[model samples]
Target: MKRPSLVLCCALLGIVPTACGPGSDPDPGVDRGDSSTVDLEHLAITVSGRAAVFPEAARLLEAQGQPVPSLDGVVLTVEEPLRVGVSDADSVLGQGGIGADGGFSVSEVPVRDIHLSLAASLQQEGFVRSSTIIFDTAFTRTRPHTDIIDARAWALPNAFHDALTRSIGDASIRAHSGERASTLRDAGFILGRVVDAAGAPVAGARVVLDRDDLAGRVYYPAPDFQSATQDGTSATGLFVYVHSGTAAETFSLSIEGTQAYLPRNAGATPGLGLVLTLYPGNVSP
Candidate 1:
């Protein structure tokens, strides 16, 4: 079957998928053009935590009964005026290197919210660098004197956002109370199914969920966070996308090969699931 054009999906969702193309700024809410101009007190932001491999990558390993990847040696960078998503090359505010103990600290940071980007190189000889993981939550100063930022990157299925938020919250509380914060680990899931006009399962359909605010930043399931699906849909036309966070946020859904589907676009919540139905009809090319 011919794959449905993504352009159509974008149109149906009332979103321009390419609005945030390279070199284009999609976030008008905040000005992140330059971090040097921001006049803020320089505060120490100490980050300590484990940096695990991408959830999706770890899922692949677990499926094959392979040992889970380590969280050590991950390089995390903090950026100011948080962007919609992480880029390969972005201006850095501070950086920390995760050690064998899964702890690293960056000091002398401006008192403000920051975007944290986590990246690491794989030990495999063939596959070297891993994709950078950015959380939806921004790390902000919880207290005036508190600079210690406690965090953790775990291999939890569909819980990165939740874990990060919890960690940040705990760190903020600790900073206020002048105590050390503990690590965080939480997860959430998104279940979905694609069916045809006659209510029959439509296997091999591609479904994607992305933040409405971040035009180009797409979220996927664990073990394959980069790809919505490693293989096509299941025999039952069911697919589940996981994330490490809460489901209070709204998201836009896009279905591939939707030309055969009647109502392709559906509303989605982070932890909640969605169902898309296809009808036997001729769609425009």
Candidate 2:
């Protein structure tokens, strides 16, 4: 089947465009761009616990396999700005909402001086309370995927955008805390379907995204943190494309249907022509 495209792990990082088509589809959701310079993007950040109760709550929630964003009730200040930082820019890419999933999305962001914060409003019968969390302003240095400019890259911007959005539950967890960085693991191109020597796509074959470490600093934009999918794939054997935040000097970057992940933090960027491919989908498997 001639599908559109899918970028499972697409985040907004400023860099030169390696291969951007002119007639690319317009951002489907909210438009966060101005007249100056802007690009529709997603801000994916890792929201960890800051206090004893918080982290414990997070772990408890995780154990139940509940979505982090759904923790708004347990944690206070769900409807406020708590995230702040000097992110790697890509964490705050695109604008608008694409409701392919239950969560809404938005793309088209102003390239200059980007910030993702949250605010809370209280309207209850007893002990009313309100607070807001503000994220640090992350400036865009350039467009993402510059080195791969020459690679025949194709992205399903909407799907990429959806996967990039954080649930309201995720926002609540990240709003109250300090910054905890995850090591940027070695990332590679994630194929939608397993292919044979003849490059024939394989269905139900399992094409996974893996890496070595988790050295990347997590950042959350306005809406939520990041997201995941345990659901099975379509009959076509396709999953979302994920970009590894990890970086490598001599690596095999897959140059096909995919999205780029920064193995590091929200705004960190490597040199141009950056990518690698790992066979069998494991570094030490």
Candidate 3:
């Protein structure tokens, strides 16, 4: 079979393209009952990573005097992108549990030139889940990979139930915090990256929702939250938007400015974990 162009694969990760080369199908280094796609030579890969609530969320919780959730029972998984409507059961490349220090090291993962995504979730209630595209070159068995996985909260943690009893006088902190936390739970979370045709990160790009109705409902999390209105994505070409509106909402994204890339209108649902890798002038795949 003909392989995807290097530009395409690199574009998906927002990495600079090295050159085009022959490779097998973009099958994840997973055993999905398709023995033909499994390359045993690449199975010794080791991926170590840390899982913690994002700084913004952590600060917010700390300010509220709530402790960060324990890392016990947290699970990390290495996975490959699957087609829409496809079951993920067959796409798991590897999985590991987080330690007390919120660290994880998963070995024996299948890695090649294959595109992969790392996902971390807490089995505990009210903790936000996280999934990010590797956003770099393909993982290779020649070396170990280290990653930091930042998680956040989407629901009103049971620990914060005190907010429900506070009077309307504390709306700014109590209500606002509750609103931000619940917004991520009810609506969804979106993480995006913009890249040029050659796959380098585009620094000044701004991602926007096409819906006029969602004007105030969209919010940027802390640290870089304020930057969303000023400088847009940084050199990393990363931006995050979460819904603070009522009900689950579905929408597509459009980038402002005169870039050659078209907006992705594939009905992205944030609750399902959307990590977008945008390429200029090419949105087909």
Candidate 3 worst ten-residue window by lDDT: 161-170
What is candidate 3's TM-score against the reference?
Answer: 0.47
For TM-score, candidate 1 versus 2, the one ahead is 1
Better candidate by TM-score, 1 or 3: 3
* Shift in Å, residue 137, candidate 1: 7.4
Clashes in each model (backbone N, CA, C under 3 Å)? 15, 76, 2
- Model 2 clashes, total count: 76
Determine the C-alpha RMSD for candidate 3 after optimal superposition of all C-alphas. Answer: 11.1
Model 3 misplaced stretches (Cα beyond 4 Å): 1-40, 81-85, 112-123, 135-183, 192-205, 208-239, 242-270, 274-285
Q: Judged by lDDT against the true structure, how good is candidate 1?
A: 0.36
Score candidate 1 by TM-score against the native: 0.33
Q: All candidates' lDDT scores?
A: 0.36, 0.23, 0.44
Residue 158 of model 1, lDDT score: 27
Higher-TM-score candidate among 2 and 3?
3
Most TM-score-accurate candidate: 3
For 1-285, candidate 2 gives per-residue lDDT tens digits of 121111211223223342243334222111222212222343221111111112222443466575333212322222211121212334333322212222222223222332222212222222112221112111122222111101111111222222332321233222221212111111211223233333343333323222222211122222122433434223333333322333311111221233321121121122111111112321101
lDDT, model 3: 0.44
Q: Residue pairs in steric clash, candidate 3?
A: 128-152, 261-281
Q: Which candidate achieves the best lDDT against the true structure?
A: 3
